[model samples]
Target: MRTVRYEVLPAKGTEDKVIAHVPRDVVVTVTASPVKGLEPTLDLATRLAAHGYRVVPHVPARLLRDDVHLKDVVDRLRGAGVADVFVPAGDADPPAGAYGGALPVLRRLSELGSPFDHVGITGYPESHPLIHDDLTVQAMWDKRAHATYIVSNMCFDPRLLGDWVGRIRRRDVTLPVHVGVAGPVQRAKLLSMAAKIGVGESARFLTTHTSWFLRFAAPGGYSPERLLTRSAEALTAPSSGVAGLHLFTFNQIAETERWRCALLDRMTG
Candidate 1:
């Protein structure tokens, strides 16, 4: 079975909807917000775990206060039986404390005995709006030793995504990649959610990657099938090491889940 996962933001008071709609045992990655801080993420992860889902909370390095705070977070997740975590160098405009990026937090996790079974780091197929492409690639190489896998950031062009995956493999970072795709989302809602979560770069991302936004702007909007089929050859090849699909739901859980189920039925039928 190909691994399937979902990414969700820690929107205030959305826990009930998530618990009621998301299937049991699904890997739900809770995202961190610069405005909201990490408590909501931790709280959602705990609640999701109690409801029998395998939860992976985003531990944004910039938000963490110190080593003591990191320890506390690990302990909390451990106590909740959450054994997966995704670390991202967050968008917080001046990091709160000692840790500046995901690499430092990843090292600290190792020093603290690595509580989680699967530790994921972010990948960018599309160039990050602020960070240079070379730096992003080098960052992956630097963090590979500490990470178990890579979860790519959202990208629209499958050919570009495929090329990026191949480039990573050639560079010798062989961690399995969970290719990221936006689920069935409306453009206005996506923008609203992005703004609400304080992901200002998302606006810049949309502007810089106008082609992607245009696809979504069309009638019936963007379809994951387009990306899936286009990328299949590369993703399924022996050398590609593509693990599965990671849907960026953007809080549209019901629509995302429906799309996933329909696609699964088609694949099986």
Candidate 2:
């Protein structure tokens, strides 16, 4: 329960916020925006690595132009002392180049001698908005060989998460799964972000997952501890292979940190 990782955005002021509010001990993962590509993510990751944090930057397959691009990225990250990476078949509509998904990119990384000691692949605990549940599971089976672990996308339903974990075990996917949860988000902040992103996206986000929406819209807003405590049995069960937490901070670094510490304090006492 003490172990956790904070996933940050590749946006302006993100670096400053992390440096200010987050400590050096926490494992930090940078997310790649489908629209913004991977440059900002890489830049922030490099800066964070230089600042003495164990940085894991997302290398979305759809963003890479080719093997040449992949090599360049590997070289850059290596130079920055990065030893971990998260590869996802990004949400980009028209992929940047030859690579369309994470498999080819993962294979290419192996061809490049696997620069990263830790390579993370995505696991959908709940059904993905676009991809079918069956395809997501199959994707994990295909990606298992290349990845060192799995980081699930945002999932609000703990019971659903538990069921997904059981299914993975039954399928013989033994990789350690890091459960994804949003950290200490405020309702007003959520609405503000929704407004900023525009109604089209907000509506899509709000409507896609009913459980997620209810939790978000519920009284007093979202609280990670609610999910964590409810999901404890699943997380610690034998053969669950639940590694730790992958918190979606959404740049709420200070609040997330405080929430984490508070949760830990409660656990201890």
Q: What are the TM-scores, per candidate, against the unseen true structure?
A: 0.94, 0.92
lDDT of 2 by residue, 1-269 (tens): 46689988777898888888888888999987666778888999999999999999989898899889999999999999999999988766689999989999998888888889999998887676777888888999998888999998776778898999999889888999989876777866655654443221223455676766876887965668888888989989978998899987767888888888887898899
Q: Which tens-of-lDDT digit does each residue in 92-205 have in candidate 1?
A: 778888888999999989988888999999898988988997788889999998999999888778888999999999899899999988777887887666656654245457
The TM-score that candidate 2 achieves is: 0.92
Per-candidate Cα RMSD to the true structure, in Å, reads 1.8, 2.6
lDDT of candidates 1 onward, in order:
0.84, 0.83
lDDT of 1: 0.84
Q: Which stretches of candidate 2 lie over 4 Å from their true place?
A: 191-206
Distance from true position, residue 85, model 2, in Å?
0.3
After superposition, the stretches of candidate 1 with alpha carbons farther than 4 Å from their true spots are: 198-203
TM-score of 1: 0.94
Task: Return model 2's CA RMSD, one decimal.
Answer: 2.6
